[model samples]
Target: MKRIILIGRAECGKTTLTQALRGHKLQYHKTQAVNRHDVVIDTPGEYAENRELARALILYSYEADVIALMLSATEDYSLFSPNIAAGATRPVIGIVTQIDQENARPDRAEAWLRLAGCKMVFHVSAFTGDGIEELLTYLDASSAADENV
Candidate 1:
């Protein structure tokens, strides 16, 4: 499996999505530091929330096969720049979490991610398992493609 580095603001469900992708039961765990699992690198939301720590994410991106930019559908605004992922050497994808939230607006999240230069965006709800399979499928395909190169 290709290793994926997930970056996002606090409470964007990066940890939950990592667990889901690993076939583990969903659990709430605060990531205080970079947590490297078998195929996922979960980072603290503060890394994205604070501009000073943003450099850490760039360094971490170099260690993964893919860079995943996550955003919550309920977010009122995007914390990322329009070209946030433009400097990444690896393929960057977007994931919109909290798709099942009552105030969820996946379209808005997708738009924001697109502006951030994410060519492929996935809208998922970890709680309901919605769109998880497709995300996994994409990851599998990405890994395969990486192996070929």
Candidate 2:
């Protein structure tokens, strides 16, 4: 699988998404620092929200095959500005989380991610295991493609 670095604001489900991908039992664990599990790099939301620490994300991105910018469907605003992914050398994608919520507005999240320059977007609910397979399949395919090159 292609390594992925997850970036987003707090409570966007980065840690939960990682657990779902790995088929682990869902538990609430606040990410206080950068964590690596196999091909997934889980980052604290503060890293993205704090300007001074945001540069660390770029450094971490270098070690990843893809940069996944996450956003909660319930969020009213995005921390990322337009074309933020343009700065990333790695392929950038978006993951819209919390779609299982009754009030989720996945379309709105997708729009923001697209505006932020995500090459593609996915809707997922970590709690329900929805869309995890497709994301993993994409990663596997991308990893294969990278190996070819």
Candidate 3:
């Protein structure tokens, strides 16, 4: 699969999504540092929240084939600015997490991601395995395409 680096604010379910993609048991494990897996680079929420720390994400992005910007459906505001993906060297996709939440506003979150310049956005619920298969299929196809090149 194409290696992916996930970036987002704290508690946005980046870690959870990582576990889900790996088919591991879904547990609440706070990411304190960068956890490099074969296919995914799981980053701490603070890295995306602090400007200084966010540089670390850019560095890590070099090691990834794709970058994922995560947003929680319940977030009232977006941390990302418009056309943020335009600055990225790699393909940047958006993930709207926690779609199963009672107060989830997936449409609003999708709009924020689109405004941030994500050409592809996915609505996922890690707890329910929703959208997991499709995301995996996408990664698989991307990786396959890269191998062909």
Quantify all predictions' global Cα lDDT against the true fold.
0.90, 0.92, 0.92
Per-residue lDDT of 19-67 in model 1, one digit per residue for the tens? 9888899989999999999989999999999989988999998899889
lDDT minimum window of 10 residues, candidate 3:
140-149
Please say which candidate is ahead in lDDT: 1 or 2. Answer: 2
lDDT of 2: 0.92
Tens digits of per-residue lDDT for model 2 on 40-149?
Answer: 99999999999999999999999999899999999999998999878778888999999999999999999999999986898999998889988998888844454322
lDDT ranking of the models: 3, 2, 1
User: Model 2, which residues run further than 4 Å from truth?
Assistant: 143-149
List the candidate 3 regions with Cα displacement exceeding 4 Å.
143-149
Q: Write the per-residue lDDT of candidate 3 for residues 1-149, one digit (tens) a residue.
A: 78999999999999999999999999999999999977999999999999999999999999998899999999999999999999998888999999999999999999999999998899999999999998998888845443222
What TM-score fits each model?
0.93, 0.95, 0.95
Candidate 1 vs candidate 3, lDDT winner: 3
Q: Global CA lDDT of candidate 3, please? A: 0.92
Cα deviation of 63 in candidate 2 (Å)?
0.6
